[model samples]
Target: MTSCFNEMYLQGAVRPPYARLEGWTRAMPAELRQMKQAEAEALFRRIGITFAVYGEGGDPDRLIPFDMFPRVFSHAEWTRLERGIKQRAQALNAFLVDVYGRGEIVRAGRIPARLVYQNAAYEKSVVGFVPPKGVYSHIVGVDLVRTGPDEFFVLEDNCRTPSGVSYMLENREIMMRMFPDLFRENRILPIDSYSERLRRTLASVAPAKCDREPTVVILTPGHFNSAYYEHSFLADLMGVELVEGQDLFVEGEYVYMRTTEGPRRVDVIYRRLDDAYLDPLCFRPDSMLGVAGLMDVYRSGGVSICSAPGAGVADDKAVYTYVPEMIRFYLGEEPILNNVPTWQCGRDDECRYVLEHLAELVVKEVHGSGGYGMLVGPKSSAAEVEMFRARIKANPGNYIAQPTLALSTTPTFVADGIAPRHVDLRPYCLVGESIDLVPGGLTRVALTDGSLVVNSSQGGGVKDTWVLAE
Candidate 1:
């Protein structure tokens, strides 16, 4: 029978309808599937994976868009990846602290000092201040793509307010109903502890200068951010106050957040706003979305910011290629996960080589994300290639090129029934007293046929990842 996979793990219920689940089986057994559908909706409601729409001010709850099927990962696979990611984050954290504190790497000429000062994300305000526990990046979401059997590569690192763990939590709940039999029968690693882990991680670095239990706040950029659901979700899960930029103020040496009860001291802030928008006084004076003088208070050690400002430099596309070396240099260990083959445009030789092979490489803007400013080599038109060639020639360092990779595919339900689609996983990790990784991650699928762009902004849908027992 043609099921998604061998259904021997399914208990009680009949094996998944692998063969018969074609055209007629969809609607004819709608009610039977309705049981699964109803259960999912009910679970979602109970879990409250809701988004707060702007117009609806009072009971602002909107259901997160979710799918029934979950992508599964083996425990052994997760163990290896978990170790790799933790080590990678640790190294990056050390790099950020050193970059701003002593400029060791920059002085050593590993990373250009001009690049640091000129980066759109770099914050000069955080130069002298050290973060609590010396942890600059507490939460990190590392994106990974499978190119072939047991071969995975790092797509990017989401260090500044990396989101999507809530979706991971909610997705697990949905999967339980969609495949109740499998969930009950198979051994699935529970991801329910993610929120708690996040709380501990945030709490761990609470203004080490303070003696009391620190109040952690989830700083959001208001509601327009695409990951607003995640911001609110994490806030609710962590039982922390969710504050927008305007809801905060910096007074003298400390930062305070507005609440029904006047102003309350904020010991730690898990800010989701980009570094440029965290403090207008420090970075961009014209920015209305940032708190004035917020960075001053943070630098004074009155409050801790998760992933202290300027952490983005480590995630720079060019710096990504050097992560393995950084891992070895800092951690004295080999990276368990692999990096995708990347061609650095900053290198004169690599730029010439990339230009010659324009039609076969995936050219990308180093600074952009969410699938913006990217050109798939095999899919680009002649005009596009010519435009990129000129753009790269003028500013080679602004771009990076990688060979087109055939990312692994998973079967997903679509208009044409179940079919294989390219997918990638981004797992959220919390670094504190210890490392905690959510068992499942956000599984993004490229909806268009043969389309490699998988950002949600580029019409990608998310699936709940399910790590099944061996």
Candidate 2:
């Protein structure tokens, strides 16, 4: 039997980082644990911290399952991970800048020109104009999974609007409220400053034309869109207004928010909508989600978009294979964090290999997210695999495949008892005048016994992550 690496234990002994949790888990009775879990759920409901799962039939706003057991890491472990994350974020922004400006990477043959020019995420609207501070991706979320005690790999990059940061904050708050003693016993780093730091990062990237204090706002697609809770929650935390498309208007080169007082000039927009929906005049004509003339204002330096539309080029699944080369070309340093070896199905030989070994690999669409449009070869039945094989054959350019990794497991609080479950981390990296991230991030676990997917939409739950203070 192939045993998955357990994060909390080694040779049946508790690891140093998880030593403090040993007694807490033992002293708590099952009844008390159940009661606390119920209390956590009630608190979530009262606070209105719920996510919308569209097409789920019943009540759409459902609470994401929260686990009491925290995933712990030592100070040294986090320091290393932090450095790698920062390096990756810097490289991503550099690549975005180069692709939109010089096209040097393409000329040098480091990345294919078609990969950028033909990519759905690439935009030619703001080609000549650069963002303030030249930072294209203001906030970067890097998905990571571990396979051993000292091994971690970057699963994917989220350069656009990455969600679930609200969960990170709420999880810590709930944990502290429920078990203040556990926090007191352990020396863990504080993540309370993330909102303030995020605000500062945004303000630092205000457009050059701004003379007064920059006004920041969170642009949402409204309550109907998923991740609405996060949009409203972040706005409240950052002391900014949460506005829909109808709430804002653009005239003569500047964007403004309609207010009871008057038209308020807005300088920075942390938009949560997609690129095509950003400007009906520029993209999807029927979209009521984005401001008209917003892209033109952004190009003219009248307003600064948080991610600067079209930053998604860095995170495209096909573009991911060239990140290591990007690090070398842009940063002049080898990658500290490794990407899981990927096989693009667009290639004839690779596609042939994938079809032959369909049962041992995981295949995913280039544009897939939230665990949808994917196949877990080992878990799928014959008919499902055959269906996927046909789908791949029809459009080979739309898919990528990777080996089935034995993701490390963490002890989770389950119905029967504590059991090991696969988990992954998504640490949000903020880029602007400076690059930073809160010490801990959202730790998602596969709620099912042996499953590997950790997306909330796929029945996964979240756990608070702890980076022990030195």
Candidate 3:
């Protein structure tokens, strides 16, 4: 358990609640638990809560593990995080505009041009084009966690295809059945209207010349990646068609999709695929997960795409350190949220500092996620640390280090009963003409005894976040 908490802090997960009530000690009746599980399964069938996952032999269906307990947050804490997230999203939008339009920040040396041009994520296709609403990244998910009673730090910014909102809604429904008495008594915040916010944001960025009721499609990568549930869920809730890469095409300056009737004009696309897989003509030429000539149509102002193509460059971990500065530089306001102390390996002084403190710090590869390319101090072997040291020296620009944090813990339900598990919150944001962030978001938990990795791909699970009624 000590090692788990130690790793969690090292990895930058939000500090969890300290108190834990274990087992049947605080659990509801067994019959209640079973009833809740059954009720949740029924609700899943009725509401069609799904994410497409490819099973062996190429079959695909939505699959997400739903939990019955809803993590509760006070309004006071939530409001602060919301303000910070909106500010961050706005600053990122501003940064994207500068990068693609003027290259002002890059030329001014505020950010490295090498980082911009060399990153696999950056694109030259949209350099001169502007979005419909002058906005990119219509949806952003900011990962956060409570490290203490009031200490919540910003983790990652998921501007490109951030998912797991469906889990938030479905988890809450399960909780309602599993712990009805506790839920009723506790002042949990409502998170049912997220899809409404999403729909509004998507509509807000429709093409200026689009018809009164613009046709929006959710572009997907065809059921192999995780978080496919969120893709279909948002599409169903928004009442839009969910399309794969092959279903779309570009004709003239307008983008269109293949329907039963024929090619239909598409004004806005809520794309769930990454940049490289979005348009083969614009990005990786060999990618079959993209439509040819799609970028040209978007560039010509015939269509709008969420999070635009090059938005990922701004969400990089190294780029994150400059966010507060970006907020101040662009918005002329102080940052509402704080970032954990960071060490950029590219800087000589920073690299020296991190190397000296390797025994007490956590290091991460700038581009990797799901807890890969991580080294935890106080837990790493000498051999492991040396290997990481060499890796950092080899690609200093791609590595960063920070002091391990003691992420707070919350009481989580497990097979052994209730125990303290590290947890983090990822609140969703919709940035169109304006910022529209949902009150409740997904609360991911590190399910291992004391392990701090909370990614679903890393065997982590989730809980529904309940923002208490104000």
Cα lDDT tens digits, model 2, 211-292, are 9999999999998888998999999999999999999999897999999999999999999999889999998999989999
Error of 3 at 186 (Å): 3.4
Among these predictions, the greatest TM-score belongs to: 2
Please give the TM-score that candidate 1 achieves against the real structure. Answer: 0.86
Model 3 per-residue lDDT at 134: 72
From the highest lDDT down, the ranking of the candidates is: 2, 3, 1
Q: Model 3, 137: alpha-carbon shift in Å?
A: 1.1
Candidates ranked, most accurate by TM-score first = 2, 3, 1
TM-score of each candidate?
Answer: 0.86, 0.99, 0.88
TM-score of 3: 0.88
Q: In order, how many clashes per candidate?
A: 3, 0, 15
Candidate 2 local lDDT, residue 439:
99
lDDT of 2 at 354: 92
* Better structure of 1 and 2 per lDDT: 2
Clashes of 3: 15
